[model samples]
Target: MTNNTLLLFSRLYHHDSRVFKEFLNQLPNDEQTMPINSTIKFEQQTSANHSVPDGAITQESFKIVIETKLYGQEDIDQIIKHTDSFDGEKNKYLMLINVHQIHEDYKVKIRNKLNEKGTDVQLIDTAFEDIITSFRSVINEYDTEMSMIIDDYEDYCNGANLISIEDRLMRALPVGDTLDHNFKYKLYYAPASRSYNRRHRYLGLYTRKEIKGVGKIELIVDADYYKESKKFKWEVVEGNKDQLTDEVIDNIVQSMFHGEEEFGYQIYKGHRFFIVPEFIETKFEKVSPGGLLGAKYFDLTDYGLVKEELDTQLIAEKLKEETWK
Candidate 1:
C-alpha cells in the first residue's frame, strides 16, 4: 500500500505550530479553520507520577493524589502495539503528555527512590551512559523514537544522561569533530517514552493578552481518537451539552463515541481513564485578575467546555468578541 495519508498535531507548546501546519500544505487538498482571537491557551501544557514521603511530610501548594484503575494487561499491550504501529518509520513519535492530570495519590507515587544499594556513583553514571550509548544500538531501532521532559532538576538528573556541554562544544567546533547523533541531539533535547522525561507545551501559564491574536480555535485531537471518534473533549460539551465532568465525559465517550462493546470501559486499577489524552483549543475572553472563568474544571473535557462557555458568556457580556470578526 501507499503511504499517502499523513496526520500531524501540535501537542506541545515548545513545538512550533508552523511545522505541523506546513505539513498540511503538502496534502493534495487540505482545508483548515482557526479561531480569530485566541488566548494563551497553554498557548502551553506534563505527565508525572510523583513519589511521596511516607507518613506525609510538610504542607504543599497543591495536593498530589493518585487515582489508579485496573486495565487488562491485554488492553495495555494493544495500546502499546497501536502506538508503535501508528508512529511508524520516518514519522518520529513523541508522546505529548500533560503530566499534571494524574490524581493527587497518583502524582505522589513517582518520587525518586533512594536506592543506594552500594551502587558506585561513577559506575552508575558510566553504566547509564553506556546504556544510553548502546540503548538504541543502531539508529532508528523501531517505530516511534522516545523522549521525555522532567520539570525539576532532580528528575532531570535522574532521568537523563548528563549531556556533556564541553564534550558537545568540542565535537560541534567546526565540521572536523562531530558525533553521528549530533543531528538528532541538536533537534531534540531528549527522546523518551513517558512524559515524565519528555517536554510538554505549557500553554496554561500565559494569559490571553500574552497570546494576543492566535487566530481561531484550530484543534487537532489525539490522532487515533480523532479519526475513530469525530468528537473531542471540548466538542463533547459544545455539541452534547454535557456538564464536562470526568464521569460525564466518560459517559459521553462510552455512550456516544465508542460503545461499550467496541471498546470496553477503560478502567486502570480503579479509576476510569480516557484512552486519548486532551487537546487544547484556542479561545478568546477577558477576565479580572484571578477571576473565575465561570468555573474552572481541571478535567480536559470540562475545562474545554467551561473555557468556551466563559468565553461565550464574556463575549455576550462584552462587545469585543463580536468586534473581532
Candidate 2:
C-alpha cells in the first residue's frame, strides 16, 4: 500500500521543496488507495491534463497546468464548485494550496476547504519549513556518523535516520479534536490532609487516578477570596504545561513563577486543599523546568519499564493534567 503512493513522491523530490517532496516520497505503500479521478494544484487554478493512474499514483500526477491566483473565501468556494464538476464515484479530489507570499493563517484557511468527510482538508505530515529548521542538526549528525567514509565532497553525506526527525514532527502535529496521548499527563503527588489559605502558598497533592475520553479539557483553579462573587478563580495553562515549586525561599518575589530557583524544587500548578473556578484560562507557556511530562503510546516500546500499558493509561496523567478543568 505504501508503495503505491511512493510513485508520486519520487517526482515531488525533484522539485525545489525538498522537505515536502521527501515526505511525499517516503510514504510507505498503503493499501488504502482510492480512485483518484484527478488531482488539482491550487497555486494556479486549472485542470491537470495528465492521465490518472489506474489505482496507482505516478510521478507526474502532481503537475499543474495553470497557476491559480485566486485568494479569499470566495476563491475557495469557486474552487470547490469546480471540484464538484469532476466525476468521482465519491468526489475525492486532492488539492494543494501553496501561496508562497502568505501568512500561516492563510495556509490554515487553504486547508479549511471543508470536505464531505467533516474534514475540510487533509494536510501531509512533512513540510518545507520543518526541514529547514532541522537541516543544520541533521547535517551535524551526518558529519559525526560518517566522518571515516567521506574522502571528499563527492562522498560527504551520512544520511542518518532522517525519518525520525520527520516522525517527531508528525507526532507533535495534533489533528482534529484527536489528542496525542503522548502529550497527556497524569496525577503524581503526596496527599494533603487539610486545606490552607491562598495567601500561604498552599501545596496541592493528587491521589493516583487514571483518565479517559476524547475532548478538549477545561482546567480550573479557585482563587482564595472570591467571597462576594461566590465563584472560584482558576489557574490554568495549555494542555501539557507543568508548574515548578519552590517552598524553600521567598526569592520567588513576583510569585508569578519566576523560573527554576533550585535543585529540590518540586513541580506544582495549584493546591490540593482549595476549590477552583469552573472555567480557568491557559494563559502561560513554558510553565516550568519540569516541562510537560506524559508517556505517549509510542513511548511504551519497552515492556520492562511499564507497570500498566493500556493505551489510555499511557498518557492518563497528561490527559488528566490537561483536562482537570
Candidate 3:
C-alpha cells in the first residue's frame, strides 16, 4: 500500500541490473536472458491495473512487471487485469513479491489468463525473504551510497517482519574453543502468525532460525519456566511484585511449559520452542536477569552477555565477579 517501498525497489532494480536479474532467477520457471549489463529501464504505475504492479522493468525484448507486497493479498483478477494493458509482444512477466507462500491455484489461473490473451506473461512469485537475501548477496560489491541504501532497506524489511531470518547468528561463543558455560540457551520458534502486534515485547534473549516450511523461528529460553521454578523465584523483579497476581503467574507458567499440542512438544520437526514474555513490567536492564529469567536459576554472565558490550579488559578482571545492573 506504500509507494515508498516500490520507489526503493525501482531504484535498486535500475541501479544494478545484475542484482535485479539475480532476484528474477529465484523464480522456478523464469528464464531471464537479459544481459547482466543490459540497459534496463524501471518504471512504476505503468500497467492495466495501474495500481496493481508496483513497478516494471524493460530491457531489449524483455518486460518484467513487478508487484511488491508486505501483508496485502491481492486477488488473482487484479493481476490478470495487467495483461489487458500489455502490448502482446516481448517476454512479459508478472512478479509478485510477498512473504507468504503463493498458492498454486492462483499461479494456474494467471497462466491460463495469459494464455487466453496470447501473451507470454509468466508468473514469478518471490518471497520477501528471498528478495532481501538477494540484495544481501550483492551488497558488498556495490558503491558506498548504493551499499548504504541496500543495508538500510534490508534493516527496514527485517524490522517490519517481512523478512524473518536474522543476518548473523546470535551466539555467545567466540570463534575458537568453548570452555565457558555462564549462560544456558533455549531454542524456540517464533512463527510468522505471531508477528503482528505480538503480546510480548521483552523477548530479551533469543535467536532467529529459518525453518523449511515455517518462515522464521526464534530460539530463546523458557522465561516462564525459569521464573516459576523454586530456583528462580528468589530473583523475580521486585518492581512488579504487586502486579504478579497468583492467577496471572499461574497462567503464564502453565502457558509457557505446556508444549504445542499440534506438533507434540516441538514447533516442527524436533524444534523446541517457548512463549514470549507478557504482562511482565520491569526496567530494561542490561545486566539484570531478574525480570523473567532470574539470576538465581540463570546468570546473564553465563553467556558473557554483560561483558561482551561493556569492556573486554574489565570483563577479564571480573570473570568470577557477580553482575549487577
Instruction: Please give the RMSD to the true structure for each candidate, in Å.
Output: 26.4, 17.7, 14.4
- CA shift of 80, model 3, Å: 0.7
Compared with the true structure, the alpha-carbon lDDT of candidate 1 equals 0.22
lDDT of 1 by residue, 1-325 (tens): 0000001122321243443234222222112322112211210111223321111101122111111112111222222222221211222121111112223222222111111222111101112222223222322333242222112322343444332211111000111111111121111111122122221111121133221111111111111124254544333201112334464344434433333243453321112211112212233343545432221212222222333343323222232232110
Q: What TM-score does candidate 2 reach?
A: 0.22
Ranking by lDDT: 3, 2, 1
Better of 1 and 2 by TM-score: 2
| Model 3 weakest lDDT span, ten residues long | 173-182
What are the per-residue Cα lDDT tens digits for candidate 3 across 1-325?
2344565556677776676676557555556543344576667777563445667766676776777666544576677776655564466777777765465555667778778866767777777666656666665563777677767777777777676322221112111111111111122333324432221212233111110010112223223234334332312211233444454445434433444432243322222233222211112223543232321112224535452353323333333343333
Estimate every model's Cα lDDT from 0 to 1: 0.22, 0.26, 0.46
Question: Clashes per prediction?
Answer: 51, 27, 6
Runs in model 2 deviating more than 4 A are 1-43, 47-126, 129-325
What are the TM-scores, per candidate, against the unseen true structure?
0.15, 0.22, 0.46
Per-residue lDDT for 1-325 in model 2, tens only? 1221232232233322444333333322112232232332322222333322212222223321111222212354443344332332232333332211234444445456644425322332232233233333223345542222222211211132111221111011111121221122211111133231112111122112212222122222221223356433333221111332222112112121222232232323333312111111121122234323332222222222242333322333333344221
Mark the regions of model 1 whose C-alpha exceeds 4 Å error after superposition. 1-252, 259-325
Scored by Cα lDDT, where does model 3 land?
0.46
